[model samples]
Target: MSIAPKPNPALAELAVLEGEWVIELSNAKFLPGSNSRAQGRVSAEWLDNSALVMRQWQWRRQGDLDHRA
Candidate 1:
């Protein structure tokens, strides 16, 4: 697959994460303990001058674990 190019400076600067991010998970904890922990990734790309698209993926683990996206 062809990879997407990088965004411009103006678009990059404008793409701040100013809003609140609400994440939901299934039987996962934000921290590691007796409960299983989930690792996630956040990626951003410019859709236009005024907006951007963000994506997130979640995976479960106790320690160093492979992530699937």
Candidate 2:
């Protein structure tokens, strides 16, 4: 008899966000004096040192992700 290996929950959660993600917030304020389209970019990658790092950047300028105004 053969038994299948159990899936790793941490890996599963990490899988969902393993790729680059672009998100936009419509008419939302992010900072104290920011009231415009909030765009964000998320990057997830595993380093060669066996460490997983997630980086994100948010902007409210043009040419960024549209917040659907």
Candidate 3:
């Protein structure tokens, strides 16, 4: 038989971030040639109450799609 350990107190505190977020970046002068604007969505959740996992989907102003898993 196996038992799961309790989550760390500090880690559990991070549960407050468990939700969806809308992100926007405007006039970011990182690129040399063109101004950059982006919109994205982030989803955060706790996995098995042990690990915090975040997934993100983003679209650049030029219609480029980015995803992180």
Candidate 4:
């Protein structure tokens, strides 16, 4: 029989962000035009209960799609 290893406390601490979140950006110069607004959804979760990974998708007001790992 095989036994699973205990989870690391530091890694477990990331559980606080294990949910869907709404992100909004306003008055950002990163956009093509000035004074832009963007919104998206961020999903965070643990990978195999060991590491935390976040995936984000955003749509800019200028019809642009952005993703982050």
- Please name the candidate that would achieve the greatest TM-score relative to the true structure: 4
User: Weakest 10 consecutive residues, lDDT, candidate 1?
Assistant: 18-27
Q: What would the TM-score be for candidate 3 when compared with the true structure?
A: 0.59
Look at candidate 1 and tell me the lDDT of residue 28: 39
Between prediction 3 and prediction 4, the one with superior TM-score is 4
Would you give me the overall lDDT of model 2?
0.57
Best by lDDT: 4
Candidates in order: C-alpha RMSD to true structure? 8.8, 8.5, 3.3, 3.1
| Each prediction's TM-score versus the true structure | 0.34, 0.43, 0.59, 0.62
TM-score of 2: 0.43
Better of 1 and 3 by TM-score: 3
Q: Judged by TM-score relative to the true structure, which candidate is superior, 1 or 2?
A: 2
1-69 per-residue lDDT for model 2 (tens digits): 976565555565566666677876665464333455556676777654244567554445445443321
lDDT of 4 at 66: 69
lDDT of 3 by residue, 1-69 (tens): 978767877796788888898877776775333566676777888877788888555544446657454
Going through the candidates in order, what is the number of backbone clashes in each?
Answer: 0, 0, 0, 0
RMSD of 1: 8.8
* Local distance difference test values of all predictions, in order: 0.54, 0.57, 0.71, 0.71
Residue 69 lDDT, candidate 2, scale 0-100:
19
> Candidates 1 and 2: which is better by lDDT?
2
Q: How big is the positional error of residue 1 in model 2, measured in Å on the Cα after superposition?
A: 35
Model 1, backbone clash pairs (residues 3+ apart or across chains), number: 0
| lDDT-better candidate, 1 vs 4 | 4
**True-vs-predicted CA distance for residue 30, candidate 3, Å:** 5.6
